[model samples]
Target: MAGNVQGESQFDVIVVGSGAGAMTSALVAADNGLSVLVVEKSDKYGGTSSISGGGIWIPNNHHFAAKGGKDSYDKALQYLKAATGGVVPETRLRAYLDNAPKMIRHLEAKSRVRYAVAEKYPDYYQHLAGSLPGGRTLDPELFDTSVLGDELPHLRQGAPSNLLMGRIAWTARQAHKAMSREFGWRFMVLGLMLRFKLDFKWRRKSKFDRRAALGTALIASLRRSLQDRKVPLWLKTEFRELVVDGGRVCGVRVVREGREVEIRARRGVIFGSGGFEQNQTLRERYLPQPTQAGWSATPPGNNMGAALEAGIAAGAATALLDKAWWAPTIRVPKEEKPRGVFAERAFPGAIVVNGRGKRFVNEAAPYLEFVEAMYKDQQASGAKSIPAWVVFDASFRFNYAMGPLMPAQIMPDSRLRKEWLGTVYWKAPTLAELAAQIGVDPLGLEETARKMNEYARTGVDSEFMRGGNVFDRYYGDTNVKPNPCLAPVQKGPFYAMRLDAGDIGTKGGLLTNEHAQVVREDGLPIPGLYAVGNCSAAVMGLGYPGAGATLGPAMTFGYVAANHIAAAA
Candidate 1:
């Protein structure tokens, strides 16, 4: 089960991929008195889940009661219907709303998996029929990895862009508190830094921090639970194709250690192998024009759509193959992954403009909507809008960080990395000079800045309504007057950074039914086959309802798939 084994092996359930959903499927199946095995394509077990922000958007999770919050299924469905724009079936959306909370509670009661309410996090579409400002998204607690023992090395390290100073880690609540510079954040940072610096035992092994936070915490917790359940997880095992017999998927043909191995699944084969964001061929084939594989913020080498392709070969239908979980990202030099440009755009004293030096969108919009606007603007205008510029003055440089660049007080020009200062990101003493530096029109930029100053004084964004929504104001600076997202950008020494239409991952893959069964084009379920996570057509369609929309439905469906399979004879 560890390696090629070079022969036939059998398990009650064969779960593909090692992310949150896959692990849940395996662990849950084992809980139901079935043997389970997990196969992962990458050497690391976590896939992209280890590097993600780790927010699970469960509509009515157990944590809500204790937090004095409540939600109804009908309200959740109404909001989803509006947000999803009716593209997804109502039954599928209803299934997710019904099962997500149950899944979270089941895992918490039976396994090491636990989540706390991210109290202040808001839903992406607050203006919809039913949207809560907080209490829906749950964040994983930090985990001590001493329990992982020898398996520690196999756990994936997070991208530098996801961590503080390219090394330190923080939980979602901690990150939000730190971003706002709220009280006790300094103490929290000091505690983590001291723990990291003082851990001589961990330092002897590797430079990585022993405490896993955010996505790493979630994955490590799941892995520990799987270990306790005696679920075998095979690394470097690639799903070559499905093995169907008697018109049912009975097993799979996989390549492990560069050799073919056929394994039989007595009950079912569940796919949680993520999406095709890392597959360039698929990106060019299905995605919008000007798309490139390098721009996706997903893990560098994983999710090449091999699993999705195998599912398609097995006659699983597909939908939304061209859509992605879009996010505005920046190409940070020396970093392996693109850093998502979240929160930074929502801060005051910042404006995102096309190459013509005109504001194109509300910088404080949801990340997915921000990128969608970028793509739309780029298509409407030419290449000028594809690589838009985020312009800000020295006040912004001193107050907030942009991409890889730290705040001015922490990382001044003298102490900054030479490769990034003037070439990768731009800086100048005046708007026209900054415009010249970034190839933006001087007059247009000057005029835009003047209007921005006027808007800052008036506290109104007539064009895009930057801070009009509660979602935008959640990340906005409360200290700012009138509008939390607006500020004058007339200070000297303006800075600019180029943005790319990046994403957390591709949102489309094998289409599935309400029970998480992979279905054919004829809307018939494929017995003994299920798909979850980014490898399945999302339940919310093109809409991102909340912070953890991706992981929420994924785990819920994985739970759904396991139950569906376990109920079989």
Candidate 2:
């Protein structure tokens, strides 16, 4: 271990973590000609953002204008007000909406980060006021990983199960056809294979790198920008505490390379280190009961509330401690990380049921809404809904991907012999047999299947109205007629997988005002302290308005914080 280093490093700005929020802050600050240092606790950069779908929900962005879509501030505000039930202040929401477009314009104009509108993706609640079929979500464009050079190896990677064969990255548009085994995707797969072959050769000399998309692409683009700007990043450095002078935060004490190091931030210390989702004690104390840290989708060794704790010790106020960005996740036996299945439940010929084998939700609802339904069922029936089972038939499996099981892929016979098949996945010749194998009531499953078949034929789900909304059908199999989201479970063998209530990250953290400055319990800004992203209380409050709700405010406030620091300078 090295000896203590006191005041050996100094910068105008210090950013903790390497997620979108932290990266955005570092980039913007550096662009303003400020010396910035980024410290990441993990071995690699990119926190939960890297593993995410990488969609940023920006209302009235330039892409909307280019696509001839009209969106107004008042209209966007109206939608946010209704969605969040006015829990988030109008000033804060306005800050997010107003700064969001500016952030996009700045990043595109000055940095390597590029974005394109997801033309087919709809708002989570399309039926609500001020919602559009598309144009609100901006997905990061595909990035060439070779651009990162030596920095490529230091970036966190997306889950192997999320990618194609652990190398190829597919866009949302291509995924539908690819997972369904459509022949059109063959050419796309071939192109990816050739690219990976070349990438593998390059990897032998350096590290694994290829064309990356989704969250990985977003982070890579930002990292490329950082490298271009020559900003310094310190990995394996943990923030220990804040250094306060005259009751104002001015620097931070950190453990760097197994030694204590004191770094001074001449301007301010921006806390974008993410949330406490990976901290089991914090999760149990703040989140709803039964929601454990093991169920979080965030990478291991995340924020763990270090920033929040430091802020609290400095007299900061906290909010929304009980909320999170919820989703449904399943852990396969062989897979190291749990996978979040967003589209599987919404696809045709599938239903999510409690232990009693009864459908409790509109399986076609958004992931957050689906998890809310799971919690409601759990509250009503105890542990019955803790591990909800997603049941499907042969036609569904052949036409759609479930968890890590791609369409048309065969499970080995040895899996069944070792009972691994029934552990994470269950398959049987009949509904009764599947229920018996999974330990659910056979009669209830039989009746449920009978009603589902009737609904499929009639093109209506009378129980939960599964296919009633545009958002529901957005992920549905459009090739299927009448009701694209409905199909009978008549074909066997059927399949079932247990899903638990999981979250992308915790939403609760240090509270900040509209300017992205950390606020004290007395409603005053902490002079030299700032917070953004999951490290701060979510600007959306407890409600998720769309697909990129989490990243929207994260990037916007990161922009807000950096600009504020620049103005102070």
Candidate 3:
């Protein structure tokens, strides 16, 4: 129950969410002499963004362009258009590219953000129609988390450390080889890590170099900057209603600790609250399958689709509500732990099988392809085939690196111990026994294993042609004799985990104009209302083109919205 509210408490700008978009907008507005107030519905401040890959793909940036990389406006626009399947209006793509570099520079110079290009991370479709290899993504260099002082507790960390900002290191295969043969590269990587650890340790930090820990660094820097600028961040405060006047939003009705307060804004209100991924009712209605609806790589608390719902109720145009930033994840049932096993599937030599106990699809295929196949399997006849199992042999477990398994190396030992305390799962010794434990047809499983061993012996993938792609081969261990991907699912004691369609988050929300303004159903711009991040259907449409696609657009459009607001003012 919220108390009746209101005197009109005013701010130059009132941002409704504490995500990167909202926070960036607030900081920009505040630094430009606007009195800003950021309200977050969750108990914490940073939303899903705080636990993300922490990459802002800003192309043609002056800093990056000087560092031996080149990205033209034409190239960036072409890439976006191709990635979006040509449905993305040219004007919108132009706005994103034009503003992205400025935004990157602005934040780097004015805010606490420090960025550098992910020089080695390649575009997902680099060989496709239009793509820029390294220029497309910009990630923050590890920031000084101590800058936040007391605000450190409010930050969120992603589950997997490798996906987090500034945690990139040589792969497990590369590390092993370097340590064994190339002592120079091994020492170099080890020395860099040692220096990184010592730097954090000297600062009296407890844990550093985790992916989630790295994310916390960026959030800390942002929070400290916001606090320094005196931007009021209302944590545990939820946006309940939009106070619209003359068909334009002028303020918001916020519920904080059961009290309603009306926050009036001079310029506008922005909805950066993410999608409704965790909302059971909405997911069941829009998502492809019942099992795919609830899983998330981020935290479970990111169920706020309030922005999208409120926008629809207020007659805003919506798009792609039935889709997600789709991903295929091994659903480690409710009893097991929930860290996404993408690395396991993405890693070489792993194979996914249906209940018929046969390799159904290419395990090392692109993420979207894997997800689509999972949806396709759901349409098949057998009830047992609906949720498939991702099978990997003992070779897969010990040789290849799986997601979040090495917690001591990737995440803080505490978080590793906390999240994975009792969730260690593996099966071996006999395929039949493993099948029985995982509830698959034993005969089918055995047949699948026999066929896989045949393919492994020949060093070719006959069914799926899995190692055919450059991406698949990029993660493959070339040293493996025959079929890097085909390691004879014959290892005594096979391992299988039940998997369902998982996602980074939901993908559908308010439709926005080139300026990132929320567009009405009739295609009229809803002044004073802007939406970005997962609160809007991505400009890239239904598929994630690359690793940083989500963060790339979120920051780019966020920059566009702020500039539009400033120019209008």
User: Comparing candidate 1 with candidate 3, which one achieves the higher TM-score?
Assistant: 1
Model 1 per-residue lDDT tens digits across residues 161-267: 55666666678787777666666877987887887889999878767777788888889999999999889999988888888898899998898877899999999
TM-score of 2: 0.95
Give the lowest summed-lDDT range of ten residues in model 3.
172-181
Q: What is the Å distance of residue 486 in model 3 from its true position? A: 4.7
Q: List per-prediction Cα lDDT, in the order shown.
A: 0.87, 0.84, 0.68
- What is the per-residue lDDT of model 3 for residues 245-274, given as tens digits with 9 covering 90 to 100? 898888888878787888887788878788
Candidate 1: residue 20 Cα off by (Å): 1.0
Model 1 RMSD in angstroms: 2.3
For each candidate, give its TM-score against the true structure.
0.96, 0.95, 0.86
Pairs that collide, model 3: 161-211, 428-493, 429-492, 429-493, 430-493
| lDDT of prediction 2 | 0.84
Clashes of each: 0, 0, 5
Return the lDDT, model 1, position 99.
94
